[model samples]
Target: MSEHAAVDQEASNARRGRGASGGAAARRAARSGGGPGTQLTYIKRKINVYEVLDEEGLALIE
Candidate 1:
């Protein structure tokens, strides 16, 4: 092959390599909860208290 053709072929091969591996890498990242630069947020709420009555006329607070 001519030098130019050889170079073009190598570039094409590289792009194919990256395309295949890139998808695998992306899938792995997604399965593992994404990759770097991924952020997660959580919301916190207060617990409520309640009162309960028993059959013996006793009150219980929880």
Candidate 2:
């Protein structure tokens, strides 16, 4: 192979190694529940709608 081809191949291999390691690290982070930003704050636990709004109140709204 040409010198340029060899250099390109080496760079590509290096990038692949880094990418594999990065993917593993990401998986580990995910398995650990991720960072604070990955929290499920947007998700609310199951709640009984009837408890918050009675049938009469719902009927009024409707």
Candidate 3:
């Protein structure tokens, strides 16, 4: 194989390896809530909610 072809193959393999491992690591981080020391804080709403349904409409659904 040519030097260029070999380099391309190596890069492709590296990308494939990174993608496989990165996916599992990403899932783990997501499940772990970004590891220890990360505080879960409530995000305050910037905009007020627009109430579309009235009390009667809500009561009928309930």
Better lDDT candidate (1, 2)? 2
Evaluated at residue 41, the lDDT of candidate 1 is 65
Using lDDT as the measure, which candidate wins?
3
In model 2, pairs of residues that clash are none
- Reference-based lDDT, residue 31, model 1: 84
True-structure RMSD for candidate 2:
10.3
All models: lDDT? 0.72, 0.79, 0.84
Off by over 4 Å in 1: 18-62
Look at candidate 1 and give me any clashing residue pairs.
none
lDDT per residue as tens, model 1, 1-62: 59999999989988786565467668888788764675576876787876566655563333
lDDT (10s digit) by residue, model 2, range 1-62: 69999999989998776565567678799788776665456777797665778899899999
- Candidate 2 weakest lDDT stretch, 10 residues: 33-42
lDDT by residue for model 3 (1-62), tens: 69999999989988786565567778889888885875789998899889999999999999
TM-scores, one per candidate: 0.27, 0.28, 0.27
Give lDDT for model 2.
0.79
Query: In model 1, what lDDT does residue 62 have?
Result: 33
Ranking by lDDT: 3, 2, 1
Return whichever of 2 and 3 wins on lDDT.
3
